[model samples]
Target: MEVYSERQRISNAVEVLKERQLTVGLVPTMGALHEGHLALVRRALDDNDIVVVSVFVNPTQFDNQDDLEKYPRTLKHDVALLEEVDRERILVYAPSVEDIYEGNTISQKFDFDGLEYEMEGKFRSGHFDGVGTIVKRFFEIIKPHKAYFGEKDFQQLQIIKKLVEKNNIPVAIIGCEIYRETNGLAMSSRNVRLKPEYKEVAPFIYKTLLAAKDKFGIESASEVVKWVESQFSKQDLLRLEYFIIADTNTLKPVEEKTNKKSYRAFIAVYADDIRLIDNIALN
Candidate 1:
């Protein structure tokens, strides 16, 4: 697999592919290639003539400096993992911060029609702006026929869809299923930071969501929220940051399930210092 760091080199490479009428699929990632990331790339390879995996850890996305500093950067291992996926079709664009942002690492502001007002957007100020900034940059640079993103970050997926719709960008945004461990823990790069003991209890986060899903229709949304909070309160290390059941489309907190719209249970938990987020559709 060939890897390109500079923007011009990859743009030139993608241009050559486009001239031959090749359909390129892009998978934007922050490195630390786990099974979850590879799942996206694998699907891209199956769907398109060429797959481009951009593995740069974006600094603008992190609200906390410590979190950004501690975020994993495993480009060598990442490339090896992608090599295992496909040696020829996969082009790894592991660019430097300067290469991505061009020395201006600041994030751009976006209006997502109140889509960025809750959940992750509420907690991490200007986070979606950073996501939009980088993802849009990639869209312009690579000009892929399609882009793949995981549904684990459901809110971000919706925001990106909005980004394309509003801007008239000609790329199909595909949201893939959430990849999980055998025991049900949602795969995340932050999973690498969890201590052995923390890892043992990490699966409980998914278990609690499953139980909450079971209680979703029977109990009121507020009642289910309280029950989820109580479940986390019993654990010493795991702390519940926020739990809300909201309409899947608008993402507004819903008090009752209606036949008009779909809903999902979104949860954010802190396993010690590591923050994990997961959501399950409750229809």
Candidate 2:
């Protein structure tokens, strides 16, 4: 696998690949490779002749400065793991902040309609705008045939799909299934930041979501949310942020299930100061 730290250099390299008539697949990620990240790359390898993974913990995406500073930077370890995926046909684009936002460095505003109104968007201000900015930039830089993302960040995935639709971007967007630990914790790079004892407690977010899913079939969305809140209350370390059953497409909170549509239970919990988010299909 080859690595490039500059946008122009990688653009030149990908241009050469395009001249050879090779189809390109992209899996954009922040450094610190985990099973979840590799899942995206693995699928990209299967679908395209060449795959490119961009590993930049974009500074613009973090709403909290402290959180941004705390974000992991494990590029060396990440590249080593990608080498295990494929020694050839894989190009790793690990660019610097200046490499991406050269010159004036102004961030573009993205209008995601009502999609940014609740949940993560409500909590983390300007987060999706940052996401839209970096993703739009990557689309221009990589110019891949397809790009892959994970369902764990369902809201972000939807926003990206909408971004492409809104801008008429040519690449296809694929949302891979959420990769989880055997114990059911949704895989996240932030999982590395969890306090050791809290790590064992983290999987309860998924377990509670699983229970909430089953309850959704028999109870009202509000009732199911109360049950989930109660479950989290039992854990001293887990602080429930918000629990809501919402329409997958609109992302508006749902009071009850409708047969004609699909819904998901989205939850956020803070365990020993480490925040974790997970969701499950309710329909």
Candidate 3:
């Protein structure tokens, strides 16, 4: 597959593909390709005529400097994996900070209908604003027919949906399923950062989720949250950040049940400084 390192070149190439009457699909990523990323590419391939995978580790999105510094950047290996997916149909856009931001280095603000007020938003200040800025830039540059994102970042997915809705962007925002390992840890680029022994303990996060799912059907949100906290407390390696069962759409904690609404459980933990987040459908 061909790779473009310039934003204008990416825009021009996508425009050329448009001229060919091709439906472009965009899968924005932060490199260090895994099965989860390839899954998005495959889904994009099925639904669109051409898929453009972006591999830029957006600096703006990370609130922690060390987190951004530690974030993996394996372009050579990432492209090698993409080559296995489908070289002819995929165009890898591995741009630099200068390429994406274009030296427009200034603070920006964005609102996702109060989405950034809770959960990750409550924790990571200005995180989604950075996400919104970069994603907004990607949309403006790529102009894809459809953009694919995994539901693992369900909150970010909701935020992007809000952005698209508020801006009236002409494109479909497709959220794919969360891919997992056989032992049940959610597939993440950060998974590679886990220490060898810690990786063995990481699957407990999912095991806890599975158990929480079962308990959620019979227990209250408060009760489940307490149980989740207790589970994390027992393991010195895992520190629970926040566990809540909330309205899927509104993302507010749901104390009272509604028959028609959807509910989900979102959990974040620090597996010895390597934070991992995962969620599951409760109903």
lDDT of each: 0.94, 0.91, 0.91
Candidate 2 local lDDT, 1-283, one digit each (tens): 7999999999999989999999999999998899999999999999999999999998888888898899899999999999998989899999989999986455688888779777998889888888999999999999999999999999999999999999999999999999999999999999988888999888888988888888889889888988888888889888998988899999999965789999988988898777898888878
TM-scores for every predicted model: 0.98, 0.98, 0.98
TM-score of 3: 0.98
What tens-digit string does per-residue lDDT give for candidate 1 at 1-283? Answer: 8999999999999999999999999999999999999999999999999999999889999999999998888889999999998898999998999998888999988988899997999999899999999999999999999999999999999999999998899999999999999999999999989999999999998999999999987888999999999888999989899999999999999966778889999999998889999999998
User: Any idea what lDDT model 3 has?
Assistant: 0.91
**Position 87, candidate 2: lDDT:** 89
**TM-score-best of 1 and 2:** 1
Q: How far is each candidate from the true structure, as Cα RMSD in Å?
A: 0.8, 1.0, 0.9
User: How would you encode candidate 3's per-residue C-alpha lDDT over 5-102 as one tens digit per residue?
Assistant: 99899999999999999999999999999999999999999999999999998888888999999999999999999999898999988888988887
Model 3 misplacement above 4 A: none
Poorest lDDT segment (10 consecutive residues) of candidate 2: 103-112
Count of clashes, each model: 0, 0, 0
Q: Rank the candidates by lDDT, best first.
A: 1, 3, 2
